[model samples]
Target: MTALPHHLDADIWLLHMFSSQAAREGGVIRRKVRDVDRIVGRDAFVTEMRRRGYRVYENAGQFVIFCNREAVRRVV
Candidate 1:
């Protein structure tokens, strides 16, 4: 059997990413939707974000993840 790609493992990648100072400080993170899909899958990404009480927004094939649980409001 062939080995799976490293990115296919979401837990490890998520741990690494979230362990960063920026993430720890609840800074915004931007990632490509295709990258997330390829790494952790779109559903898994969304589920993980929700589980962590974070917010996610999608636009133009990109995903903007808010690392904090604060309420988000849109301003016109």
Candidate 2:
């Protein structure tokens, strides 16, 4: 694959809606979203696990995303 994207993609879509409190530093962790019923909100490009039919993380009664290490490797 090419170099990692410089910016969050604007195309495609995924389920990520973690609350600010859940945001963490260093390394990533999938979070859950609450208001993902609409489209324009998802941050484009679904989480790797979500795409591969894994248990996408969740928190505070919502679907969130943190990065998926294993699924991504298998994809490429």
The candidate maximizing TM-score is 1
Instruction: After superposing candidate 2 on the true structure, give the runs of residues whose Cα lies further than 4 Å from its correct spot.
Output: 1-26, 29-32, 40-48, 52-55, 70-76
Q: What is the C-alpha RMSD of each candidate to the true structure, in Å?
A: 2.3, 11.8
lDDT of 2 by residue, 36-69 (tens): 4343345433443456444445567766444333
* Every model's TM-score: 0.81, 0.29
What C-alpha lDDT values do all the predictions have?
0.84, 0.40
lDDT tens per residue, model 1, 1-76: 5655776577887787788887799988878888788778888888899999999999999988889999988998
- Residue 68 displacement (Å), model 1: 0.9
Candidate 1 — what's its lDDT? 0.84
In model 1, where do residues sit more than 4 Å from their true spots?
1-4
C-alpha root-mean-square deviation, candidate 2: 11.8
Q: Whole-model lDDT for model 2 versus the true structure? A: 0.40
